[model samples]
Target: MFELKIERVIDAPVAIVWQAWTLHYAEWFVPRPWTLEVIENDLRTGGRSALMMRGPDGEENSSEGVYLEVVPQQRIVSTDALKAGWVPAEPFLVRIDEFAEHAGQTRYTARARHWSAEARDQHAAMGFEPGWNAATDQLEEVVARLKRG
Candidate 1:
């Protein structure tokens, strides 16, 4: 398995952290000033996962995929390997997100598993670490806001 991973302990309860992921993902999924537009959030197994990312330069990129697995707040596994209704497409990577109760906070882990080492390296070269880390930081802020209200 060629994988790239990021782990962080968010200073919020698992429930809030999970809510940030499930409900407020659009607020933190991409690093700003890149914006995300959620086309559909059918957060269930085999459901659609689609979003468009808009850059500050007016550049736009769309991602359309399907959820491979969903386990409530515990885990979310999605891939662009297949689209809705099992339509095959050009493979990129499978994303795995795991959330756990860590003492009084949330232990969050996100992994991108690619089809090959070359693919993994390509993803890393695409700024996986910094971008994901910034997104994770945004996630913490979202979680905090969710916790406050």
Candidate 2:
């Protein structure tokens, strides 16, 4: 599998970071100039997280996927965001989020793995890194602000 990974140390606890992934906070971490509309989310293994978000161009993008793995405050794994909950969408992508304590600070990493090199290249060509990193940065900022209060 081909993968893309981004890691950063956020000034927040594990639990605080965990909340950022939930439906409540997800609404904010969505990339700007676009909006997220969550259709359903159970957030557990075998559960679904479906949404139809509109992009800046007024196009609606549908993402329906399931939670493949969930380890509270430690790790999360899920299938391609654009795939149906039951099937492996070709060029399938799996997202994994891992968190650990580093000198009392939370070290978090978000990794995205795709099925093939071409698929990985396509995602990169689509500006995956910049878009996702921006969203993650936004998530970090929100978590920090929430933790401050």
Candidate 3:
């Protein structure tokens, strides 16, 4: 197994960052030319977090995951290895997001643990870093706007 971690110190409060992530997720989950549609986002353990990303070319990629843990404004752990109710599925990756207040800003960390090195390599090749980084930038922009208003 391999893991990929990305961190950013966003210029916003932890509360704002958390709200943008948990509530306004669809707004920034995907980059431009790709739109996100949330099917379900129940923020609790064993709840479903399903969504589809529609590309400009009309291609769609859907992902379904179960929330393993949710700590308000602090951390969230989820995985595609299981759906709601702990049902086993084809394992893909475990995603962990952590938020912390740092000098009036939010320190965000996103970690993806793949099932194998091959999977990790594939994700990297698929532009995981750039995609996630752009998504994070979008998240920060949204949060900044929300904070201003």
Candidate 4:
């Protein structure tokens, strides 16, 4: 079981940060210039989420997953990316989002668990740092925009 976790202290309230994550921000939550469209986001426990992300190379990646747990503006645990309507994919991926408030700011942590050690190593070597960090940077921007509005 390999674990990859990244956390950032976002300069915003927890609620605003949580909204940016749960809402349809995948349309812009990537390192490259791409778009993410959340086909369906049922935010309740055992609900479903389906997203289609378009890459700069004009590639489209569609993922369908299930919400395993949700604690308001605090935490979200979901299954790995699957086919539409919660169908499991080969070499599945599970995602967890842990949110909290610290010193009046929000702490956003995203963790991913892969099915194999080789997959984990591959993701790490393939630049999960740059990819996720860049995405988080965009996340901060989204939160800032919400605060300004």
Candidate 5:
């Protein structure tokens, strides 16, 4: 198994960051030319979280997972290894998102735990870093706009 972590200090409060991440996720989950269609987002433990990401070429990738833990404004742990009702699914990745308050800013961390080195490498080769960075940038923009309102 392999793990990858990314962190960024968002210039916003933890609440704003959390709200952007949870409530407005679809708005910034993907970079330009790509779009995320949220099929379901329950935001509770054992609830389902599913989405279909459409690429620029119109290719669609679907992901279905169950929330393992949800701590409002603090953390969220989910895995595609299991579906709703804790039913076993093909193992892929476990994602953990954590938020912390640091000097009035939001310290955001995204961790991806893969089922194998090959899976991790595949994700990395797919431009995970750049893709995620761009998504975070978009998230920051969304949060900033929402904060202004």
Candidate 6:
């Protein structure tokens, strides 16, 4: 398979969740102790999205991509296969995030589609599920705070 997926029922409205994803992205993109720095967050089709994850020990991972599609609070599709202006990029994976209203809560799904099964396996070995799960939990917390005020 070429896709890795994570789904959760977050305890917040879809609007709040969408706000967290778009406005307060760095606040919850990664688990605590591993902070994220959003270099750029153009939430539009063909716009650039760049972020840096800073580890406690000064390690950093930076990812740059272009949004392939953006549908407000409904769905987002981005890929590192091309940067801003559709420049050729060293491909990694295409990420798709979907959010839906479910009984006043948010039904969220994150999908990472790799170019090859080997790439998918490498991502799995790199702690995709647990890391993404922690990020989802963090997203829920961020949305909860947004819901408060």
Best candidate (score: TM-score) = 1
Candidate 4 per-residue lDDT over residues 57-81, each given as its tens digit = 8899877778878999999988755
TM-score of model 1 (CA atoms) = 0.98
lDDT of 1: 0.94
Residue-wise C-alpha lDDT for candidate 3, range 43-142, written one tens digit per residue:
9988998889999999999999899999999999999898877888898899999999999999999999998899999999999999999999999989
CA lDDT scores, all candidates in order: 0.94, 0.78, 0.92, 0.81, 0.92, 0.92
Can you give the lDDT of residue 16 in candidate 1?
Answer: 85
| Top model number, lDDT | 1
What's the CA error at residue 12 for candidate 3, in Å? 0.9
For candidate 6, what's the RMSD?
1.0
Scored by Cα lDDT, where does model 6 land? 0.92
- Model 2 bad stretches (over 4 Å): 81-91
Model 6 spans > 4 angstroms off: none
Better of 2 and 6 by TM-score: 6
The per-residue C-alpha lDDT of model 6 at residue 19 equals: 90
Cα displacement (angstroms), candidate 6, residue 142, comes to 0.7
lDDT of 3 at 15: 94
How high is each candidate's TM-score? 0.98, 0.89, 0.97, 0.88, 0.97, 0.96
- Using lDDT as the measure, name the better of candidate 1 and candidate 3: 1
Worst 10 residues of 1 by lDDT: 11-20
Better of 4 and 6 by lDDT: 6
Query: lDDT of candidate 2?
Result: 0.78
Worst 10 residues of 4 by lDDT: 80-89
Show the colliding residue pairs in model 5: none
Q: What is the lDDT of candidate 5?
A: 0.92
Q: Local error of candidate 5 at 75, Å?
A: 0.2
Backbone collision count in every prediction? 0, 0, 0, 2, 0, 0
Report the C-alpha displacement of residue 45, candidate 3, in angstroms.
1.0
Task: Write one digit per residue (lDDT tens) for candidate 2, span 1-149.
Answer: 69988898888888887887663545564688878888877677877877787888998987778888888889888875444447655435888989898777789898889878988888899888888888888888778777887
